[model samples]
Target: MLERFIAITADFSIIIPFIYLLFKGKIPLTISDKLIYVYIVLTLIRNIASFVTMMLGVYNIYLYNWYNLLSFGIIAALYFQILNNLYFKMLVIAALILLIAIAFIDYRTLLNVRTTEFNRFSFNASGCFTILFILFFLYELIRKLQVKKLTEYPLFWFSSGALLYYSGTIFPYIFIQYTFNNLANRDLYWIIDAVLSIVLSVFLCFSIRHMKHQKTV
Candidate 1:
């Protein structure tokens, strides 16, 4: 019960920034900003869909997994915009492939009543997104070459958040996948994911704030 409470708190906290952005006067149109907006909208829709499914007791987690894939896609796009380098185009391609794979897996869930096979596919597909996610930051750190570049732009926070999150999640997620054991301690790992979400959302909100300030200056 406490974990659920904490999860709700963390989830709602992350949603606050998107809520603020949605109601703010005009939407941001820069490639990065628009992508964030789309991500935010998709997150909201996914949550709503989740709630409906849960109320119906449908037991479908793939819906939420697809949401995660889309979120990762947006993150990859955001990173590319920040780095704005030709080499990052490869990362974009990887992100697209990840997205397509997840979509195909998700579509299978609807076609077949049995979800276990689809769940397995969804699980690995989400992992693939995480792999791409970790690669994006690794590439960023390697190719950027200038430490000062991390500080010069607003998207830096998004990049840093990704780094922190990718670090926190990659091991646990992979471990669970390989072990294939339904350990009793599984819920504990959600704390890592939740913390990352809260941290990333706060950083993203500040980054947007910084960008807004720059526009007026």
Candidate 2:
């Protein structure tokens, strides 16, 4: 119950920046901003739905797999907009292949969306893919060698949030089964997850705030 409470708190915290966006409708967001907006909203709805379904004793975790797939696609597009490197393009292709394979596997393994199981393959592959893209995104930034402070750059904050999240989550989520069997005392791991989530939320808010400031300046 405590774990669920923490998860819900972190999940709902995402809407804070989204609410800011809604209130500042006059502010135009870049394509990347729009993508992040959609991602956050989808995540918020999925979280709320997951909680409701959990309370009703229904199968709903599968919904998150769909969210994961869609989030990858949108983030891929965002990266495509940010840089035009061949490797990044190939990374997008590989990610697409993995997404399709994961979806196919789920469809074949489960007759319907009613199971306690999670798609480990897709989930892990996504973690790895995100890490790669973030590394590339960071390298791209380094190559440019921008003179501006990192904090003032919106993309820097956005990419940093993603980097911290995927990299932080890779081990815990991928080895969750092993963790449960070997390490029963896993509260510390969850605390890390919660911290990463809050950081992502804060960075996202900063990214938008910086974007708004950039536009006005």
Candidate 3:
């Protein structure tokens, strides 16, 4: 109960900044801005689903896996742009397609209504690819060019949130079979994810608001 409260609070932490964006009706013309806007909507929908799923003791496994895949895919594409080199854009697109194909192949299994299990294949594959792409993105950010004040860049903050949150959760997803059956372990996983989410929400808020000042200027 307490952990759920913590998680909900952490999740809603972005609402203020999101509402600000809604009212202002403007943001810096950047991929990061678009991604954050979509993310805000998705988070709201996911939270509602989470509430319903919790009370009913039913899991929407399809939404869970697909949302992960979609979120990672979007961020992956955004990072490619942020890296400012379209050299491997074709390869990235191919990889994303393959990721989708892989998920589709396992759709029936993943969507099994009777089984109270998650589709680790989609979850871990998406995580691994996203993490790899992000690592390369970071390398590019540092090596290809040196921006004077990267800290102010929205992508910098967005990537920080994604990198930190995903890195922490991806490993657990890889080894999910070990802890999925244990109530206490599952709760621990939720708590860890929730804490990371708090960090991410803060960074996301900053990522969006940094533009408000730019808007004024």
lDDT of 2 by residue, 58-144 (tens): 987577667777788877877777677877788788787877687667673244577545555666788788788878888877777
- The per-model lDDT (C-alpha) reads 0.60, 0.73, 0.69
Q: Tens digits of per-residue lDDT for model 3 on 1-217?
A: 9998987886676676578667667554555577667876777677667667867988665566667777767766676565555665765787788888777776774566544455646677777777777777777767755655667766667778878888888887787666543545777777777888788888877777665332100
lDDT of 2 at 137: 80
> Cα miss at 198, model 3 (Å)?
1.3
Candidate achieving higher lDDT, 2 or 3: 2
Q: Write the per-residue lDDT of candidate 1 for residues 1-217, one digit (tens) a residue.
A: 8887766665666577676775566744567667766766776677666667767988555665556666777766666565555766676767577667755754765455434323334444455565565566556665665444455445555556656766666666566544322436556876777777678677767655544422100
| lDDT score for residue 84 of model 3 | 51
Stretches of candidate 3 off by over 4 Å are 109-115, 181-184, 212-217
After superposition on all C-alphas, the RMSD of every candidate to the true structure, in Å, is 4.6, 3.5, 3.5
- Give the winner by TM-score: 2
Supply the global lDDT for candidate 3.
Answer: 0.69
In Å, residue 206's CA in model 3 sits off its true spot by: 1.2
lDDT-sorted candidate list, best first: 2, 3, 1
- Candidate 2 residues lying further than 4 Å off, grouped into runs, are 108-111, 179-192, 212-217
For each candidate, give its TM-score against the true structure: 0.71, 0.85, 0.83
